[model samples]
Target: MRALRYYEEQGLLASARSGSGQRLYADTAVNRVRLIQQLYGAGLSSKTIAELLPCVDAKVSTPESRERLLVERDRINAQIAELILARDRLNDIIDATSKPNPTCDYV
Candidate 1:
């Protein structure tokens, strides 16, 4: 609930209010929240996600928004590449450490 409120405050989400002031969300809000989580997990800042949200919500892109999205895509791709490299490095370490060693009792 706090997270929903934060997202609402950040303009990444919207909610309606009932007569008793309870929050109401449309069915689409679930997908929107998932997308928000994905974007954040992909390393986008809230501000950048906010800038991209309108285009996503409208399903229409202006030239400027298209360019911005392109830039963000590139950024995400770079981060993916970096994470892949890090994973490979960890795998290499694991392979090396997993070898049987007579000298190390822990092994």
Candidate 2:
């Protein structure tokens, strides 16, 4: 609960309090926090995730909102492309290094 409160304060979660002062997290809030955790796990910084939240929460039925989500999807695709390229390059490097060193070997 403490951590949840801290997260709410950090603009990462939204919690509403009742007249009696009981903090209640909307059902959507639970999913939102989980989404944040997922994004964080994907290597995005907290600040970047925060910036992307508006688009994430936008209604998919709206054209503008749908476009925003598509934009973010494209960005993710680009990152995946770069990672793939880097992995291939790394594999090539390793393959080259693993080849027989023509002039150098111990007896």
Candidate 3:
């Protein structure tokens, strides 16, 4: 699929070309794709994901890589906090608007 090709182009995936020039994926490709999707869903950019993938593949984390992941985690936490505040503000507005106007004759 196009997404798979894009992932390949981004260096997040690999594929072998058949004699007919069609792409071939190993059995492990499924797991790799799933991990890529998970990282993306967690708000990682392609560049960040590419940097992290090598560490993940090696099953070893250098101090620098650990620091980078920690920074990303902090960013995600901050975003979650902001979204929660925005949701609360929206709820407050909804509660206020749902109240009847005491001076309205139509009421």
Candidate 4:
């Protein structure tokens, strides 16, 4: 809970405290934070993530916003997939380069 408060102060989360100082969050806030983390993990700029949040929260023009979010998700997914492929290729190269030379002619 204290960590959550810190996150709020950092603007990674948003909430309001009650009279007793218990924090209350907007229903969508956790989702927003998850989105922020996802974007960060995908190598997106915090500024870009900041800029996109409001439009996403607006939930306006139904189909338009939905499509936009889908596009973002797809872009992130593609980046992840490309990274995985690159990793596999790197492993293959490493394995091939590290193969033991069985020929004792050089010994």
Q: What do the candidate models score in CA lDDT, each in turn?
A: 0.91, 0.75, 0.94, 0.72
RMSD of each: 2.0, 5.4, 3.8, 5.7
The residue pairs found clashing in candidate 1 are none
Which lDDT tens digits does candidate 3 get at residues 1-107?
Answer: 99899999999999999999999999999999999998899889999999999999999999999999999899989999999999999999879878787886763
| Regions of model 2 farther than 4 Å from truth | 1-7, 10-12, 16-30, 40-59, 99-107
In model 2, where is the ten-residue run with the lowest total lDDT?
Answer: 59-68
Report RMSD for candidate 1: 2.0
Query: If the candidates were sorted by their TM-score against the true structure, best first, what order would they fall in?
Result: 1, 3, 2, 4
Model 4: pairs clashing at backbone N, Cα or C within 3 Å: none
**Which residue runs of candidate 3 sit more than 4 Å off their true CA positions?**
100-107
Query: 1-107, model 1: which lDDT tens digit per residue?
Result: 99899999999999999999999999999999999999898778899889889899899998998998888899989988998999999999989988777998862
Q: Give the per-residue Cα lDDT of candidate 3 at 29.
A: 99
Model 4 scores what on Cα lDDT? 0.72
Candidates sorted by lDDT, best first:
3, 1, 2, 4
Q: Which stretches of candidate 4 lie over 4 Å from their true place?
A: 1-12, 60-82, 94-107
Query: Lowest lDDT 10-mer window, candidate 1?
Result: 98-107
